[model samples]
Target: MHTLRLSDEHLIGLARWATDRMARVERPVLAERVLGVAGHRIQDPRARADVLTAAAEARLGLGHLPRHLTQAYAAELQCADEHHKAGHRKAAAASAAKALILAFHRVAHIDGLTSPLATDPAQFTGPLRRSRVLRALRAPRGRVTASAAPPADRPMRLLLVHSANDNFLPVVLDHYRNHPGVEVRVLDTAADPATAPLAKGLGRMIASGIGIRSAYAGQVEEALRPHLDWADVVFVDWCTAAAAFLTLVDPGTTRVVVRLHSFEVFSYWPHLVDFSRVDDLVFVSEHLRDLAVAALPRLREPDAPATHVLDNAVDLARSPLPKKPDARFTLGLVGLSQVAKDPRWALEVLRVLRRQDKRYRLRLIGDSMEPGVSPALDRYRTAFAAELAPLVASGAVHMTGHTDDIAAELTNVGVILSTSVRESWHLGLVEGAASGAVPVVRDWPFFADRPHGAHSLFPRDWVVSTPAEAAARILAVNESEESWLESGHEASEKAISTWGWGTVAPRFDSLLCARFAEIPAQRRVRTIAE
Candidate 1:
């Protein structure tokens, strides 16, 4: 097979062909060609955007993200910045919003060549949003009173705010809701019809740096202000639109706490949050703290909210079940919907294991990737399906998609693999470890070279650089049933002791015990400066 060495001339022709509706079969290869060299070589911004857009379209149609993605993203940011400098506020806002969304999801928008983040330009420039920003910034530091003590007769009021994802909150919410010292109420911004649009609107305003007092903001204030006044300490999960929206209001005496997980760093949402109003900022891991501070400069300022690295609250009691005898040959990977999870890496590990022992099989424990999310994901899904086909057909791969009871599923998962390119803390991997399955964590590439990553996050022996290394580790552990069981037992003990809710919840309790100062701080939790 002769590989065509595509050059600038070939790319130019391909770009023309793309405009004329290139064959579906040629789309992936053309995207690869553009990404490999041609996209970067183009100098003119207009031409670059056009070429990159063509590449994006090709990938969306068939789906390998080429170097064109970064090129397009950079081009869009430059355009937004230039527009802002020229005083084209609306144009700049639109471009900035596009760039912001692009950073999180590859497509600027789905099928419309517009960003889902784009709103009425007037909403950002309107008096409501502008006045809110001005007033908040100009407000005196002493304006927000010290944390209000709960009424002498009542338990301290605690409000938990969440948006779309609440995987981490249910356990915490249940504990606090039942606690004798606290009263808990959950305000799901995503679910409330009155607040959902407001949440999205606030994010848009922050991304554009224009309005914070639009009609949307007013509605959000209407929905949240009452709750803000009622709570002593407010915990906002996922540092997303809802978190940014919280920064729009005066918390008065409420001590606001926000948790930053993995996704927010890659997005512009963190840039929008007013950290000064927040009393505490929580991160699930040390590496995330390192990245968040680097990504959001406000986090580095002296007046920035006190930041802490705390382990996620996980329920490990149900996970320590005895494994089936044949489970030693099965490798499990949970939550495969996100492309960042990189399930293909797990496939590679399985291939390496099967080369030596055909009995080794892979059990995927989550829903397969769904299409129409993004071009990047679609491309990954296309490639993944092709690679997964043969093994699945041969019965070497078993998929148990989207199970509510993972602990029940773990009975057959001898080894649980974390093959993600990035994660703040892989809850699935840790849960599997607690379930008496040996944990194999790929040295997550996104943070592997950083000072803190999978190696620092987990036991050094559990992190591997390659599929071969993972296979070797698995084979060594599964050399016999006794060794595998022993390894799993040790892993289970480590997870339960370190991250289980019983151990981690106290740190949260101490943080929330603003009025009740009886609880002592746990020694393990570290402030960001540390």
Candidate 2:
């Protein structure tokens, strides 16, 4: 199952069938459903090239597709990547769609092909043997190297690595950026010229995952060597290509910690990571840790690193300002964009409340849906948009868009809603709660009955299973101005006391500075974010 290869004769036969099928069609379209005689048509130039490249590989009995196909895939991925970096999210999504379509075309019409996703985590086999090369490259544990920890009093050097978004790094960065005892540098592989190839080199990543070393491996080794050398501790933000890239090289003596926030548990990257090289593997929640462990059987091996659950840093010092009497009517949802946020659920709650009281308006804070990320996302966005159109026109909802000053916006919101279907942490609701907004967290369906979810993260009274329950809670709490203020104040006090940085920051400080031996293992991952 690990070797999902199609033989040359098998591939050639499929291609011939597709070719003949295309010849028979009166009108050829680009859609996935528009099959040629065999079952699909290459609609775009990139996909067309893929057909030729795949045919060339089959004809020559080559082990891989031609260079042109790989380059085309990498270039398209980079194009989408640039859009994401520039905050042209919709445009970025559009570009990524093209890349996905081309990738699909690469395997079109073949048996066990047509679907546009990767194999399930359990399907892919990991390292079969630590070949001679692996033995030579691996850095043995507990050995002293040039980057070993410095004396306790010396400035501790830290390098933060990010493969994509860095939204969660602000707390860590702000704390150490100018610390007299620490030197910190951030490297975003998405932007770094040398490391950027590590991200965009689709062919390289594939070849390396299957135990083959290509030029891209040398490029990554060269690019990351200096940064790894300069740091006493390397904290890679996500379990992604950056983490995989780091593990490919033997870190002389630096402590490497990789944090798996949430979605990466379902991605292919975690399987590619060589756990023996990592000293610490962190997760924001326990459920995600469980799923990740289940997906990759290797984590159970003795070589797996020590695991820790670290809460995301939230600056809880910002005290809540007094709210006006009318603030009771405003419900706020802080972040949106991905389909997972499910703003439509929040709108449903708004509808339930406004049936009796029209003043119950919703303030939607964050970016509108970006349809370019995937076809599924685009469909969800379209459906959600249709549902929201009438409400926006009727003034029942206000799309405030994204903002730099979230604290200022929370002032008018008495109720903060977490309507997400899934989340590793719900930072928006907690931030709003720190500002004295009553939190109404949905029982996140992804882990509702499973261990460690919104239900376990917050007080039972703060969580609801449906829009009706959320509406009822809102109605009961906001019956009078006194009742609303009293509820909001209580929620605010609990959020800061339990989850605020005042309580959480010290844990992080201890984590970063403590000797690896001091931190306990298999601890529950906790976050007040959701």
Candidate 3:
């Protein structure tokens, strides 16, 4: 079907018409629906964005489109900055939040928005722009009454919040969800693809820190208020935007707890979070806790919540069977969806081990490294594939792709390798150990200079500083079937006693169930205009 071609001026006029209609409407719900219809008719990227300009006019508008379409929208944002300069702090904050959200959307990964935390060379880097944006966002002024603190015998209402990565929380979720003493609710932000990525932007957060209370506070309150009010104690599973969104408002009397897994310390989210609002901050490892505290000095502040290092929950009961007699020569590494897993390091170690005995084979039991996370990650995957291709063709490397049942996957493996440069805790290594596979953990380089890292986390004998050392350790354990079996048994026991959920759940209970409590009104987290 041939469509009539429209001039640029005509398209711009259509966008203007939509924005005019948006201004006339009261509720944004209707305007948003109407704008989307107009946007759908525009095949050109520029025209699509022109149509989106109408949506940005709403108080909590998020103009998160591809960067090309943001030009006309930028003019609207300038009005926000103009308002801010003219002392309309709240309007400026809202405008900045909408603009930043659109400008920094994760989908705009080509040039400027690739690294959300990195300072852009083209943009001004004054501190208050970030501080001003955050300050303008504000919080709920009236403390909504949360469910009362349950007695020792009653269940504590626990809400679990995570953005997209909930891999570490499964066992913990199952435990509390089934526990008679704790009631549970989980909110996976990624469950809704439309709004999920929007949470990743820091513009609203920067506005929040800017200190001028904003209309954004009311937006956050409206989205999260019900969950906040329902829970007695909210346990946010990751130190992500979901966690920050929960703390954006005062928890009223409900206690707030946040778990910091490995990667978040490298992001700006931790720095943006107001730690004084939290009741407890949990970590998967002490090394991560130390890194977070050092990364965000605010955690050391007097009102910073109590911190605890709870191991990532693992179910060891699934892997109790003995390995095959020849399992001694088998090496396994699981979960390689990120470049950081450094599968090439494991390959290097395999090459060294295979030189001594042709029987040695590496079993990679998860998805391959994801390509195109960025140009750097894509390059890493390309190089890794070149290295891996010949090895797989030679039968020295076995690619299992992905698996739902890791217990069955590790059964043939005798040695587990942790080649990551950084980790709060290596769950795959621990699980391998539980399955009677001896672990050879690399001294994770990110924290090698720190007081504690992989060396402190695992047994000295199990930790290695180099691929040659890893090869030597594997050889030492697998010299004989008897020696390998005995070593595997010892690793299995240690894995179960220490990191397994049977033992670790009690530690979580002490932190989430025991110490969690209602905050006094005087010390409650600040709302917009205290």
TM-scores, all candidates, are 0.79, 0.73, 0.73
RMSD of 2: 10.9
Off by over 4 Å in 1: 1-92, 107-153, 202-204, 207-214, 515-530
Model 1 residue 445 distance off true place after TM-score fit, in angstroms: 1.0
Model 3 lDDT tens row, 1-530: 12247554565565566566555554445545544555555665434543565445332132122222344345445556566767876667666655554543333322111222222312311222333333343222323443245566667888888887887788888999888888999887666443364455566655655554566666666767687778888778878787766666667777777889876765445655666567678888888888766646566555556787778887889886756766678899987777668888999999998888899999998887555555446666788899999999998988998888888888889999999877789889999999999899998877776778899989989999999999999999888888988999999999999887889888777767763243222233433334
Which tens-of-lDDT digit does each residue in 1-530 have in candidate 1? 12156555665665656544432554445536535455556555556656665655555454333334455555665665566566655665666566455444544322122222222212222221223232233232322455455677888889899888888998898998789988888888888777776777523565333542346556656887888888887899999888877777667768788999987776667756776667788999998898777656566656667788889987899998878878999999998888878889999999999999999999999998888776557777888999999999999999999889999999999999999877899999999999999999999877787889999999999999999999999999999889999999999999999999989998888787655354342121112310
Ranking by lDDT: 1, 3, 2
Greater-TM-score candidate between 1 and 2: 1
> Higher lDDT: candidate 1 or 3?
1
Please give, for residues 328-396, the per-residue lDDT of candidate 2 as tens digits. 899999888876788889999999999989999999998987646544456567778998999999988
Whole-model lDDT values for every prediction: 0.73, 0.66, 0.68
How many backbone clashes does every candidate have? 5, 7, 19
Task: Estimate the lDDT of model 2.
Answer: 0.66
Pick the lDDT winner. Answer: 1
Query: Highest TM-score among the candidates is held by which one?
Result: 1
> What's the residue-level lDDT of 271 in candidate 2?
49
